[model samples]
Target: MSLLDRFEQAFMPNYGVPPVALARGEGTRVWDVDGKEYLDFIAGIAVSSLGHAHPALVEAVSRQVATLAHTSNLFVHEPEVLLAEKLLGLLGAPARVFLANSGTEANEAAYKLALTYGRREGRSYFVAAENGFHGRTIGALSLTGKKSIRDQFGPFPVDVRFVPYGDAEALRRAVTGDCIAVFLEPTQGEAGVVPPPEGYLRAAREICDATGALLVADEIQSAIGRTGHWFAHQADGFVPDLLTLAKGLGGGLPIGACVGFGAAGTLFGKGDHGSTFGGNPVSCAAALAVLDNLDLDHVNAVAPRLRSGLESAAHPLLKGVRGRGLWLAAVLTEPRAAEVQRAAAGAGFLVNAVQPDAVRIAPPLVVTADEIDALVTAFPKILEEAAQ
Candidate 1:
């Protein structure tokens, strides 16, 4: 039996079967089990910030695992402390960090903090944007506004009101004083890399301030130099009460963090929340390596090149490109994103059909200019094949 067959026999059907069975990867390239090489444009859904098998991440994980790996949060590890300090330093704010094992867990921690604060303040509702995605867990799913995924899991515990994305007026109207928090993604990754309109984040902040509601920015896919900034909201000159991070934080290792600023930091008391592998030394060390080696300058410089290249492609299927920095989407004129993805993979490239009309292209931050130009040159032909 092939790897796909073996996967089908052993694994659950939730994720379905991935088209390719990858065996190894280095930098921005990967080789499948059959020795087929492809340019990995998706970068493991934006998780591999430093790229596959990076020496820094390898050394850090190896050293930490050899010295100390699992601590169960019962003991304080140097790597964990240093990672938290690094994140706080990046934020340049007074905040407390709760480490977790994934983006879902981080959002769950933020949810609990919001609930605790809401209970104390007598608020009972949350406002989230339509088509926004946090994660698949219960609390995070409750905050998710996508009907196709959320409707099946409903009768959620939290009371949340959904509003149109990029519409400041809709958000302002939905976020009343009775709302506990306003959950938002700086860029809606799962909803096709949809960035909100300018001043929308500032307006949300103002609305939350006026209503005494918490502003929660879920930056799971947009942070950690993905958008050429430490945090996406920082580009708009606003700070959220709570910020959830994951994906690229550990450079591919499983780690997440929920940071609360000001009084929101003190919402969770003793015994309120905890995790067994929340701050594993190995993951923390890997995250530290990612932070130490991240190149924001490279991200800023190469982003425009990629964006302009995609936009310059004279293809009838490609409508335009959206997003900032390494996080981008090629908007299609028709619902042929899956076809485009398959065509890309066949042509020795890998991208994601984030939505029926959008193909997400988030390559590794270390991808070279030549590799980018190669993709840009091939994109027109890829779309032509997909059209067939």
Candidate 2:
């Protein structure tokens, strides 16, 4: 039996069956089990920040695993402490970090932080943007606003209010004094790379300041140069009270962080939270390598090329493109994104059908100019095939 057949027999059907069975990757390219090479535009759903098998990440992981691989929270590790310091330094703020193994766990830690803060202040509600996706876990699911995925899992443990994204007035109304926190994504990646309107984040900060509600920015899919900034909220010039990060932080290794600022940082008293493999030495070392090698300048330089190329496509099916930096979505005039995805895959490229009418294109930050040009040149033809 083939790899797909083996996968079907061994794995659950939660993710459905993926079309491609990749074997290996280098830079911006990947080869399937059959050795057909393709440009990997989706970058493992924006998790592979430095591309596959990057020397820095490989060397770091290899070295750390050789030296010291696993150390539970009972013991202190250098890589873990260094990783926390590095993340805090990047934020340019004073905060406490809770390391985890995935974005979902990071959000779950943030959820608990909010609940603790709420209990202290006698608040029982939380607010998040509509269509925003946090994760699949119970606590994170409660914070998620996508009804299709979340409604099936309810009723959740927390009371969360859903507000329209980019609507400052609606958010202002939803986040009353009883609200413990307001969760927002710098860009809603799962919502087809949707970015909030200008001043929306500023409005949220002000609202939280007045209402005494914590502002939590979920940067799982938008941080680590994905939006040409270390953190997407940096573009708006405001720091959140609680910030959750994962995806691309470890250069494809499993790692996540929940950072609490100010009083929120000290909310967790003794024995509040802990994880067994939260800060494994190898993953922390890999994350440290990713942080050291990340090129924000390159990200800013190449983002415009990707965006302008997609927007310049002359195909009738192509409506336009939206998003900042490498995290972008090609908007279509019709709801055929799934068809476009399949056609692009057949034509030796990989893209994601994030929604019915939007295809997500998030390449690695290290992707070269030539690779981008190739995608741009092929996109028109890809659209033509999908249209048929």
lDDT, candidate 1, at 234 = 91
Residue 375, candidate 2: alpha-carbon lDDT: 94
lDDT of 2 by residue, 1-388 (tens): 9999999889999988899999999989999999999999999889999999999999999999999989799999999999999998988988999999999999999999999999999999999999999999999999898989999878888789999999999999998899999999988989999998989999999999999999999999999989999999999889999999999998899999999998899999989998999998999999999999989999989889999988998999999999989999999999999999999999899999999999999998899889999999999999999999
Query: What is the alpha-carbon lDDT for the whole of candidate 1?
Result: 0.95
The reply for model 1, stretches above 4 Å from the true place, is none
**Global lDDT scores for all candidate models:** 0.95, 0.94
The alpha-carbon deviation from the true structure for residue 285 of candidate 2, after best TM-score superposition, in angstroms, is: 0.6
For all predicted structures, in order, the TM-scores are: 0.99, 0.99
Candidate 1 local lDDT, 104-210, one digit each (tens):
99999999999999999999999998999999998999999999999999899989999999999998888887899999999999999999888999999999999
List the RMSD of every prediction in angstroms: 0.6, 0.7
Of candidate 2, the 10-residue stretch with the lowest lDDT total is: 152-161
